[model samples]
Target chain A: EPEVTQTPSHQVTQMGQEVILRCVPISNHLYFYWYRQILGQKVEFLVSFYNNEISEKSEIFDDQFSVERPDGSNFTLKIRSTKLEDSAMYFCASSEGLAGTYEQYFGPGTRLTVT
Target chain B: ELKVEQNPLFLSMQEGKNYTIYCNYSTTSDRLYWYRQDPGKSLESLFVLLSNGAVKQEGRLMASLDTKARLSTLHITAAVHDLSATYFCAVVNAGNMLTFGGGTRLMVKP
Candidate 1:
């Protein structure tokens, strides 16, 4: 089965530094999303992207956060001026159809550690 | 706001036993999903319930949705050790944003 894949399975960055998490969603999938989970916490939605634009975003997705599909298969999330609270596992997912009945397939995730 | 709640956050059962996980969502939604996650692993899709009274089964797991009640249940007919994992029920609101339940941690002891 084709699957979503992410790069830099693990990352460590210092506070106030910028970090980029990359994902390659399944080819042929249209909608893409980013979610994060603080250690031991429920996964939280960050943002959804389609047609090179953001469809929806949560409060957590503030100005410091940005997403880009620079190429056909690459979806990336960049967090600027990271804080200690930014440490979490960032997941990238994609769905084939509309959001209403969409079934998103998620990547393994990228664990980010901020010190 | 959309919120998904799962009951009995923790479950322990003996092999070959049975149990169920309940999910209740605040607000209206007809699209629901069930996913399994092992320790430190990514989500594994289990089922997608799209309408009222929709039922889907795979292996020893069955999931049903009731849009009227905004509730869904994941029933384990015969729990096995390999089935132990954190199961989460997520609901997509009319806005189509997916919000996950608190999660139920199941442990099937052999």
Candidate 2:
């Protein structure tokens, strides 16, 4: 079975620097999503990408956060200026068809530690 | 706004026991999903319930959905240590985004 893959299993960056998280969604999947889980907190949605554009985003996805499908297979999330609160495990997910019916497959996740 | 809630946020059971986890949503959604996550790991898909009275079973775990009642249940029969993990149920609304419930953490003691 194919799976979503992410780069840099662990990332440690300075508080004011920029960081990019990369994901390679399943080859045939259409919709891609980013979600984060703070330690001991519920997983929170960040953004969803389809057709190289954002379909939906949560309030936490603010000016500092952006997502792009720069190429056919790679999806990336960039944070312009990292904050301490941004430290969390970021997961990338992809689904074949429309939501509410299809199952989304998730990557192993990238653990971002902003210090 | 859609809210998903799960009962018995934390569960501890002895090996070979059976228990049920309940999930309730606030709105009308035809699709519901159950996922499991071990500590520090990504979400793993368990079951997808599409309509009312849809039931899917895998090994010792069985999940059912009731769209009319806006509820879902995950029942474990003869639980074991390997089944210990955090389980989440998410409701898919019109937007295709999932609103997840506060997960239920289960621990099976031998």
Candidate 3:
């Protein structure tokens, strides 16, 4: 089965540095999303994207975060300035249709470690 | 805000045992999804329950959703060591964002 793929399975960056996490969602999926899981914590939604724009975002997705489908296959999440609290496993997910009606497939996740 | 909660955050069972993991959500939703994650691995989709009374089974695992009660359950029958993993239940909200419950970590020993 086709699955979402993410690059840089593990990333380490200095605090205050900019970092971008990349994902390639299933080719045919229509909706894309970003979620983060702090160690031993529940997954938290960051943002949702559709039609080349952000459809929804959580309060945690503040000024530092931005997402873009720079190409037909790549979805990228950039943090302008990283913080220790931003260290988490970031997962990219995609669904074929409305997320409420279709199951979203998750990527292997990129573990971001900021020091 | 939508809140999802899963009970018995950690479960240890002997091989061939049966157990159920319960997920409760604070808001109304028609879509609920169950996922399994191995340690240090990605989330794997297990079941999707789209409506009230929806039930789906795969292998030794079964999932059910009751939209009215805003609850979902994942039951493991005759679980084996391979079934050891963290299980998460996520509910889709009005804006199509998924709010995931804290996962249940299952350890099935031989």
Residue-level lDDT for A69 in candidate 3: 99
The alpha-carbon lDDT assigned to residue B8 of candidate 1 equals 79
For B40-108, candidate 3 gives per-residue lDDT tens digits of: 888988998998999999999999999888889999999999999999999889777899999999999
TM-score of each: 0.97, 0.97, 0.97
For model 3, the superposed segments whose C-alpha errors exceed 4 Å read: A99-101
Q: Distance (Å) between predicted and true CA of A111, model 1? A: 0.5
Q: What share of the true interface contacts does each candidate keep?
A: 0.50, 0.53, 0.87
Q: What is every candidate's C-alpha DockQ against the true complex, given to 2 decimals?
A: 0.62, 0.65, 0.75
Report residue B10 deviation for candidate 2 (angstroms). 0.5
Q: Candidate 2, which segments miss by more than 4 Å at Cα?
A: none
Report RMSD (Å) for each prediction in the order shown: 1.1, 1.0, 1.1
Q: Can you tell me which runs of candidate 1 are displaced by over 4 Å? A: A99-101
**Candidate 1 per-residue lDDT over residues A1-115, each given as its tens digit:** 9999998999999999999999999999998999998988788889999899999999999999999999887999999899999999999999987755679999999999999
True contacts kept of 2: 0.53
Per-residue C-alpha lDDT of model 3 across residues A1-114, encoded as one tens digit per residue: 799999999999999999999999999999999999999888999999999999999999999999999999999999999999999999999989884557788999999999
Tens-digit lDDT track of model 2 for B1-110: 89999988999999999999999999999789999999989999999999898999999999999888889999999999999999999888775788888899999999
Q: Write the per-residue lDDT of candidate 1 for residues B10-44, one digit (tens) a residue.
A: 99999999898999998887689999999888999
